[model samples]
Target: MPKSNIMDTYGRFDVIFKKGIGCKLYDDKGTEYMDFVSGVAVNCLGHSNPAIIEAITDQVQNEIQISNYYWNDKAVKLSNRLTDLSDHEAVFFCNSGTEAIEGGLKVARKYGKIKGGNKKNIIIYMDNSFHGRTMGALSVTGQKKYQEDFEPLIGGTTNAKFNDIEDIKSKINEDVCGIIIEPIQGEGGVVCADSAYLKGVKALCEKYDALLIFDEVQCGVGRTGSLFAYKKFDVIPDVICMAKGLGAGFPIGAVMTNKRASVLTHGDHGSTFGGNPLACAVGCAVLDELVDNKILDKVDDKSDYMVSKLKKLKEKYNIIEEIKGMGFLLGLKLSIDVSEFSKRCFEHKLLLITAGKDVIRILPPLNIEKEDIDKFIIKLEEVIKTF
Candidate 1:
């Protein structure tokens, strides 16, 4: 990237993808690669899906952009669909995951202040967690590395350990407004919170009258073989943030809230281009493919197959330390250096992404074919042999 034109925040790869279909991607020079990352799990139905294409073509022709001053049919449809799929009573759209997190936090604060007055401003997060990079999101993000230089973020944010119910319980106080957590820690190496632990957290939140927020941006919209990862556990959060795959491939995020959000009178939070016609139309189409067409029903078998194959590879190669994550979001913990291995995989025409510090994450498109998975295994085996 030229410094004159573009910023250098992301350590992006050199390859420029020109096109993609299903789980297959092609570079500008027409070199085909098996895409296992799916744009970091954004394209749930894969690239240029027929449904999204139709939605985009039609909606772009009708209306591309609009201010939030007026209501639109597509926005209402998308919001209704999302709220129907989840336990939320209402939804708020935003531009990205970080924005969604920020919106949720704001709602929690507003709701808390109404219930307990000004003292209830504290929000608790987890260690090794990632919500987003925006200031409000960053304040609650647990890792100090991401929050250090941007010191003095929004105050009243605390940290707790994953799966440690006692630690979470100890942090609960009258001043605490809410607690946010990822049902599955996608950026934190695909770590899954135990069911019992989530239940305990919910109980604690109730005991303290604190709102519970689940950050499902990376694991929602059937990415985890369900509409949202929160369904895996029996507990329900008062507020939840979703993005990444929510709009198929469009840029959109939403904050879903239960009835507790009634405390938010008006103008508590808003976004200008959040639920515009183009994005909402695409979101509706994505939901049609996943929910109406029953595409997610096929994810279980595919996830099981992926796990079976990965374990087989583990049995064959001792370099594999363990397999983590649930459903389609998987991670391979390796005893060997992953940077060189991932680079080799890229050179071998297999796209992959790493998580945390030591794990290789596989967040492929949800509808990837079995043969494509086999091909991924073949390429992975070939790449591992070189190490």
Candidate 2:
């Protein structure tokens, strides 16, 4: 291994990946590894997808980026598609999930001011929720481990126990402005919000005239067998913060808002590199693949196939405690050390990620085939036997 001047933020693996194809990565030494991580759910169509490549190539030949002062046709097309697919009426494009969250927070606060003056500025987040790592988003993220180092975060933020409607009811008041939640908590162990719990929270937000913001960064964009996770939950939110799979690894984010939550005026918030031609082209391509090609229709059957196999694995190994999450955003709650388990899987040429302390997050590509899944099971079971 050779040393370089990269940031020490991530504890990186020793392997140097040179290239990737569908559901697989090739190292510098020409070794192949099944990529189950999918760049932590960003590569929905898998690595080096044709649609993404074509979108990039086409947009690059014309123009890669243009000033925000002028409207890009690609951005307008993507925004129109997104709004048509969901209940949202408007869209604010950004560069990443955290930026989307930050913009959504500002929108919520402004809406609160408009509705009930400055007193209604409190934003409620859920316990164990992972919104983002930026200042404003970090303040709303419920995990103290991510917040403690950056103390004195933005004010007017409170939290309630996840899946506990009573706790949330006690937490909400007249001063509450908005409530942000993940339909499926990704970094918090792939735990899902109960349907009834989400409905109850929506009722409370409606009663208090507070905007309901759904952070679907990880679970949306057909990862949950639906365009938006809120669709499956049967609870429509005032704002939806999206990113991850939106650009299919091309780096884009958006905040979709309804009429009430669209409070950002002319000079409220903006992104310099956001909604550029190249990124928006990729975003449009991803949506076309998911919607026009009927890619989302295949998700539910694949989920059933994968979960059944995982349950059988659970029956076979005592270390496998439970299966959590939905569709492609699944997790294996192991009684053994999850980090060690993940490391061993990596050693055997399988890439994966860990959530919380004990769960192994399984985020495969949306377009991955069943043969690859079967191969993953075989490799996973082989790794388990070593433990």
Judging by TM-score against the true structure, name the best candidate: 2
Off by over 4 Å in 1: 1-4
Question: Model 2, 1-387: lDDT tens per residue?
Answer: 688898889888889999999999999999999999999999999999998999999899998888899999999999999999988899999999999999999999999999999899999999999999999999999899999999999999998999999999999999999999999999999999999999999999999999999999999998999989999999999999999999999899999999878888788988999999999999999999988998889988998999999999999999999999999999999999999999999999999889998999999999889999999999999999998
Off by over 4 Å in 2: none
TM-score of each: 0.98, 0.99
lDDT of each model, Cα atoms only? 0.89, 0.94
Alpha-carbon RMSD to native, per candidate: 1.2, 0.7
lDDT string for model 1 (1-387, tens) is 324457668777787888998888998889999988888989899987999999999999999778888889999999898888878789888889999999989888987888799999999999999998989999988888899999889888888998899999888898888999999998888899999999999988888899999999998889889888889777789998999898877999999998876455567778889999999999999889988898899998999998999999999999889999887899999988887788989999998988888899998888888998899999999998987
Q: lDDT for model 1, on a 0 to 1 scale?
A: 0.89
Predicted structure 1: clash tally: 0
What total of clashing residue pairs does each candidate reach?
A: 0, 0
